[model samples]
Target: MKAIRIHEFGGPEVMQLEEVPKPLPAADEILLKVYATSVNPADYIIRQGGNDLLRPLLKLPMGLGLDASGIVEAIGADVKDFKPGNKVYGVPNFPGDGGYAEYLAAKATQFAPMPHNITFNEAGALPSCALIAWNAIVDLGHVQPGQRVLIHGAAGGVGNLAVQFAKAKGAYVIGTASAHNFDFLKELGADEVIDYNTQHFEELLHDIDLVFNASPVRDQSVRMKSAEVLKDGGIFVCSQLDSPFPAALLQVLAAKNAIGTMVGGGSISYTSSLHGTTALIEEGKVKAVVSKVYPLAEVAAAHRESEKKHVRGKLVLEVAKEN
Candidate 1:
């Protein structure tokens, strides 16, 4: 099988397309004939060894992908939920990193049946981003109808879905994006849109029930400003910040008596642990927004596009063309 793998971490140039052996399913896993996979920022971060603390866990000659949609070609002995020919989509286990290939062996619990209404490419775009959004807004934030929720980076993959998920729950959703993306975010069900380039969101919105910071602004200063916008007892869910309070930020969070939680946004354990995202997709309450698609060989280009930080939605790698 031909898959993209990087023997060493560095730049996009390191992602080499090479021949590799197909993976076999373990007792609780399923072997999938991958139809499509999507690129997440975590893919590039892992490629560069950004999270060095996790280096010991990530094997070398690593495959680089998190989300995919495909058909089950074979199921492991203990996998009773699915069978061969079942259409499925989910995130594969991270550190294992095998989605950039024609086939992957994913734990059965991480995936869910693909919705009949969507295509494989669209389903492929949902897992990582949608799961992050769901875990933040619905699961942890416990957003309720009539409450106000603010999502930073509203036009990006996770933000787009967060907007939709908040709206579906009947929360009045506010999102921050560049001026050009205002209409797009509004279309995604954001009740209010802040142009981050021109306006300070903290100055304009306050007493929020939930604040989701999906941007890369992890500095203590920025977090301090964000903390000001939350109502007393409100929750702030951040993808970039650790939840345990890094001593410095702990002071600020304690000053406001606000709740803080870190949502580890991307997980490969979706095939088993995060299949709930698939149920949301199948139920039509949520949908994946794919802003771009590239062929398998152009994985580097896909990474380049993702680096732009202006992507309105998810980007997918078309590993296998539809018949």
Candidate 2:
């Protein structure tokens, strides 16, 4: 099987596609004939050695990627919910095995049957980002109908989905993005959109019930301002992928009587998260938006694009033809 593997941590160039032995399903696992996968910040972060803390725990010759959508080619003896021909999508054994490959074997519980309404291209990108959005907004944020919800980076993968997720719960959703994406965000259910380049969001918005700071961590000021827009008891959700939530930010939340939340590895909860996202998709309340599709060989270029951090939606990689 052909797979993307990195023996060294550096730039996107460090990832090399090579022929590797295919993995077989264990008693509780299943083999997937991979059709598509998507690029996440974690992929590039690990590639660029930004996650040095994890390096000591990681083995060499690791594959890269966390989301996949494909047909089940084989199932282990213990697998019951899935069969050999089922179409499935999810983050399988995330942070351990990568999904960028012609074939992958992962625990059967790690996957859910693919949403019946989408193609392989959209399905592949929905796992990691979409599931995380569901967890953050629905599970953690407890976003309720009629609440005022503000989502930073509302046009990006998690933000875009978060906007819709908030809306689905009947929240009044506001999104921050460039003026160019106002219409795009509105299409995705943002009730109000702010141009981060021109407008100061905190200056104009207030009394938020929930805020999802899906923006880059480089903008440290944004986190503080996101906290500023919240009502006394509003919740501020930050991504743990980049910066840790500083103690000062926690103090700010405390002063406001609000909560600062950063979700971490809940590998045990992934199956439920996948099911939540799938239910939303099946209900016609959520849709996966992909900005670009790259051939498997052009993964390096995908990393470059993702690094730009302005991608309107998720970037997908077609690992195999959808036959």
Candidate 3:
């Protein structure tokens, strides 16, 4: 099997496609014949020495991918929910071997049956970003119907999905991106789109029910201003779970009697998250926004594009073709 592995931490150039031995399923694992995977910020972050939580668990020569959609070639003896040949999509193990390979043997619990409405490339794009959005808006933010929700970085992968998910929950979604994405965000069901470059969201919007900062750039000033727009007791959520919540932001939340939280390795089961997203996708309430698809051999180029932090949606890696 060929896999993208980084032997040392560096740039996208460090990711090399190398022939590696195929893995067999463990007692509770599934051997997935990967059809596709997608790049996320974590892929680049891990390639560049990882962060506090992941650095210790990572070893050299690790496969690089978080999300995958594929067919089950084999299943371990302990696995019961899926059988050979089931189409599935989910997040593979993190800080360990991942899905940027011809096959991946991961715990069965990490996967769920793929949504029938999407292609392999689109399915591969959903897991990590969808889970992050689902966790932020549904679990942490507790976004309610008719509520006003604001999403930062609304044009990015996670932010795009966050906008859709909030809309699916019946929230009046407001998104912040560059002016060019205003129409795109409205098409995704945003009631308002603020051009962050030229507009001051704090001055323009107020009494927001939930503020989800999905931007990868960790700007404390944005968080402080975001807190200002929240209604009394509103929820403020950040996607950078690894970073500490700023004290001043907390103080602002405290003054408003609002809640401040971050979306981390969520406690919800992967099965539940994927299943919910699958339902929404099947129901036509949500869709994957893929910016580009690269062959497995062009993964380095894909990483380079993703690192620019301007991709409108996911950058998918085609690992194999569906039969």
Colliding residue pairs in candidate 3: none
The residue pairs found clashing in candidate 2 are none
lDDT of each: 0.82, 0.86, 0.91
Model 3 lDDT vs. the true structure?
Answer: 0.91
Model 1 alpha-carbon drift over 4 Å, by segment:
241-244, 265-276, 279-283
Give TM-scores for every candidate, taking all chains together and pairing residue i with residue i.
Answer: 0.93, 0.96, 0.98
Candidate 2 residue 173 Cα shift, in angstroms, is 0.5
Best by TM-score: 3
Q: In candidate 1, which residue pairs get closer than 3 Å at backbone N, Cα or C atoms, i.e. clash?
A: 92-268, 93-268, 109-271, 109-272, 110-270, 110-271, 110-272, 111-271
What is candidate 2's local distance difference test score?
0.86
TM-score of 3: 0.98
- Alpha carbon lDDT at 39, candidate 3: 90
Ranking by lDDT: 3, 2, 1
Candidate 1: C-alpha lDDT: 0.82
